[model samples]
Target chain A: MTRDSTPGSLRVLVAKVGLDGHDRGVKVVARLLRDAGIEVIYTGLFQTPETVAAAAVDEDVDVVGLSMLSGAHMTLAPLVVKAIRDRGSDIPVVLGGIVPSQDVEELAAGGIAAVLGPGAPADQVVEVVRKVAASRS
Target chain B: MIPRHNGGVNSPRQQWQKAFDESRLREGPFQTLSGIPLEPVYGPDDGEYPGQYPYARGPYASMYRSKLWTMRMFAGFGTAIDTNRRFKEIIKAGGDGLSTAFDMPTLLGLDSDDPMALGEVGRCGVAIDTLADMRDLFADIDLGRITTSMTINSPAAVMLAMFVAQAETAGVPRANLGGTLQNDILKEYQAQKEFVFPPRQSMRLVRDTVAFTAAEMPRWHSISISGYHIREAGSTAAEELAFTLANGFAYVELARQAGLPVDSFAPRLSFFFNAHIDFFEEIAKYRAARRIWARWLKDRYGATSERSMQLRFHTQTAGVSLTAQQPEVNIVRTAIEALAGVLGGTQSLHTNSMDEALALPTEKAARIALRTQQVIAYETNVAHVADPLGGSHFVEALTDEMERRAEEIFAKIDEMGRGSILEGCITGIEENWFQGRIADSAYELEQNFNRGERIVVGVNRFLEGNDDDDLAILKITNEDEAKQKQRLSKVRSDRNDAAVRDALDRLAKDAVDSEVNLMPALIDASLAYVTVGEMMNTMAGVFGRHVEVPTI
Candidate 1:
């Protein structure tokens, strides 16, 4: 709504990438981003990679922030990445919430930008989104 | 004696006191967890004689001396038969009541063979897809004698019907049946994302149960207006209390609309709450919740009876507080939390097993969890008195503070309009409110622990290693799914197909129409061996799905 036409800042999508409903952190991050003047599209709970990817292409979002607390990060993240890549969007994707430190490297190897775990504050999320958005530009 | 006497108009000190009238300043967030200002110290007269409402000084005068709270340990995993074995084990361990947890598929009213239930059958809990599985869930467990509480909601009516049908077949009369159904669907909209029907239709089913129970299952709770899932969904104690009670009112409103007398159903209404690790905060939350509900039921709703005002509740220890790191530490956390629930006056409780963070509780871990409760009941004198922290200045103030803050949330929900809370919940605002508070508290605690200001034994101080030895976890048997599927298929093929079709058709009609209680129809369908999945599939087609847009 604002005159700022920045792509990443314009369309931010928040998703619970898998089965986990522990959205406390995700909700907080969404609020912080919204307050920071970003458009947030939330894709509810229990979203598989296909639905999430289709949504990414549909919404034309600049980033896909997948939240996983179910320890299914490995199984879900790669599928989402592959689906996004197959869509040929070249969208920069970021992950958050309860993905373990070890899986961060693994997810990065598979082309997920990064996975933010617990204690990563709202400010840090905004910073990462801004950086990812700027780099995309 | 040089006693400092007051000087008024001219004295500098007196002028400073007058500067209170002249003082030009305003400040910030006025509530504290303990309801205290930044007052460095406390003395005699801050607050006292803060009598508990709804008989809070103790619900009943004699308290535990007259009645001990029911030891209701929660259990469910693998197949219904497997869970039944655990139920027997729990009963043998002196569990006074039963609380069964259904698996994801069962909770969502899906059969084990449904595509969505593929690998998830009996994953989080026991699978109960039909009357056969429900029968197996309570095969030897005496339902007539012991009270049972099912944690399944969306398909609760179907499950209850199956339970009742099984019981009657076992020669247990419907009149003698006793238990509670956690039928609070509002929490489903916000916290637990498990609802087959839309909110309005869900309330209708709940109303039917409320009405049905008043006639048939007199001892059964029509609904346990729950704050547990809200807390688990990252709401604070106050938010949980407020939102949960707001939901209670919403249900009462629907029941009233359904033409049931307020007192007829209000007496059967119960509540479920979560007792987290914040010792005093949890206690105050409970005490405050009782007071608030009692007041709202009488003053706000114009209910006349004492039973209508009383807020009876069951509690479960916090499952979210457990850490996969040094999982044994969870036992201590559960103990303290269980004590909080006890001290707070929970009518019944479900303590989490230590290994629940990783997998379902192993039999050994479940036994230990039950033993933790046993120790509190028999060894520790914590339960010997009721409302032990009732009159403490800090506790009382906290109760008041929680009450005040919760009222604000309730007001906000009301302002958004009753139906609007569900949509508001979908929007990031309400979740943001919940997440903001939790995030702030969690961050403060993390920062404190990291800075060595607040010690958390193993994590930040007195660091230890190798907690695996402390856990003897119950592993899930892969055979559970196959066994459940086999039994479910038999029920599907062996029943009166015409009856099931008729019931499902009627349920669809009621759902399509204006708000209609679908419980009776649902029960009828269950009687005809309509699988949980089949029933939900009917509704899912009509109501459509609600997407809880991600928050942060």
Candidate 2:
């Protein structure tokens, strides 16, 4: 509805994927993004690939961020991206939470634009998405 | 009398304070942990009698005088058999109830052999992939005599059935069994993501429990609306109470919509909240929860029964707050939190073990946690009095302020809309930076603690380099998973192949059809010995899998 039109105008949709049931971190990121002048619509938790993709398309969002602290990310994230791709929409899906260092490459290869680790600062998150969003344009 | 100014930009804060005659600040950020104005005086009118408005005092008239809160030490790790052994031990230590915590795979509704369940079958809590697992989980415990609480969310209905079936197998009639299931799915989405089905679908399962349990298992608390995870995720006491109660309202609304009588089922609806480090704030939260829930059930939901109004909750000390550094300090922290849960009038409580930050608790540590509860129950005279802080000016003022703060958050959730709590909008409220700031503050303040500016007795100030010397962690011993897989494989192999095929086909058909409860077919499939992952996979085939929307 509104845009700051700064060099980096970020939009984030923080979500919980799979059956982990931990969304507190995602909630924190959403708040941090809003304060930073970004449009954030969290899809809540237990989002199916179909619903997540539908929201991404319906909202016309640039960045789709998934929050999965559960080890199910490797399995769940790919399905979400495939759902997006199946719809013929090209959007970068970033992930955050208790991601092991070893799993980062696999997640990225699975079409995750990026993976932010546990100790990621709110500012770094903003910066990463801003760059990713700007590149999409 | 001076006029009171509501906490808004319209009225100046000074005028409001003048009206209340509340006093100066303590602790950083210019407020008490409860965010109430602290006065340096005492008076008679500060708190109401026990069971009065604001519930800052307490709910029950006698409080702990008549009966102590159920001491539920939430313990379980490894496979079902191992946890079964551990449960007996916990009971022997004078613990009163069983509170189960399922492992990742079980929480995910996957059987142990599922490829997705690799390396994480029994890490966090007991793994129960099938009815057989549930039977072993409680092998010898008399299900009818002792109450059990399961900390499960997404697949709670299925597990509840497994529990019911287990009790049946134990010869305890379904109606006779009593316990709680943490069927708080909104929290599952809002905080914990260990969910199976999509929101609307999962809500259906929730409806099934509230509907089925209302008629069958009268003693079962079908859903424990949870704020425990919210607080553990770094929410303030006020947010914890407000969001949790809102979710509770959402559930009540769902059950009513599902055609279940409001009073009939609402009575069995329970709450689970977190007892955090802030003592007065926590106490005020529990107090406010009772008042708010009672009022809402009567006014909004048309709940006529008093049983429907009473917001009975279980409390656990904040797990995220436990520190890894000089971990013994967690004991004192847990003791204070447990006391807060007590003062807050928890119906049941789980105190965290000291070694929680490092790993699953050692026996010595878990015993210490149970003993902590016992010491409070027996040795301390605190249990004798009802609402010990009933008349403190600070606590009363805090109770009011905290309630007001939560109402504001609730108002925001209302602005977005209400209903399934799945409206894709509740997520926005959590993201409102509403609860997020707490974590930012805690993480920031932790630096001060590290730098010795903020003093924590054993962690930062005290120096003990040899603290790590030969500290033995409780390691899970035994091939429970292997044995479990072997049994499951044989069971699958030996079952009538055609019947299994027909049952699955029927289950898939039931799932694809719109508005079907699917519980009947699900229970049938279980009766036919369908694996957890296979049944869930069948549903996943029909419902399709949940996709993750990226957060920018």
DockQ for every model comes to 0.18, 0.11
Which docking class does model 1 fall in?
incorrect
Cα lDDT of model 2 by residue, B1-552, tens digit: 454445433233333224333323222222244565433222233324444333445554445644689999897788788899999998888887999988877888788787556545576688877777788889889988889999888778777877876787778988998999998877655555465676667777788778878888889999999988877766667777877888888888888887888998998988888988878988888877887888878887888876787778899998866765566778999999999988777888999998775557888999999889988877665565556675577876887788888878777766656433334234543354333444554444544543457665444456475255244555543365566677788777888778778888998888777566766776777767777777777877876655334232
B90-203: candidate 1 lDDT, tens digit per residue: 888788899888777788777899755655678678888877778888887778889999887877777777777788888898778999988887677667767667666565
Query: Worst ten-residue run, lDDT, model 1 chain B?
Result: B40-49
Which residue pairs does candidate 1 place in steric collision? Answer: A26-B552, A27-B552, A29-B552, A30-B552, A44-B548, B109-B532, B109-B533, B362-B473, B362-B474
Cα RMSD (angstroms) for every candidate in the order listed: 11.3, 10.8
Q: Give the TM-score of candidate 2.
A: 0.74
Model 1 residue B482 distance off true place after TM-score fit, in angstroms: 3.7
* Runs off by more than 4 Å, candidate 2: A1-137, B1-48, B51-56, B418-470, B477-480, B513-515
Candidate 1 at residue B58, lDDT? 38
Docking class of 2: incorrect
Give the runs in model 1 whose Cα sits over 4 Å from its true position: A1-14, A17-20, A28-42, A53-137, B1-53, B418-474, B477-479, B510-516, B542-544
Query: Each model's C-alpha lDDT?
Result: 0.72, 0.72
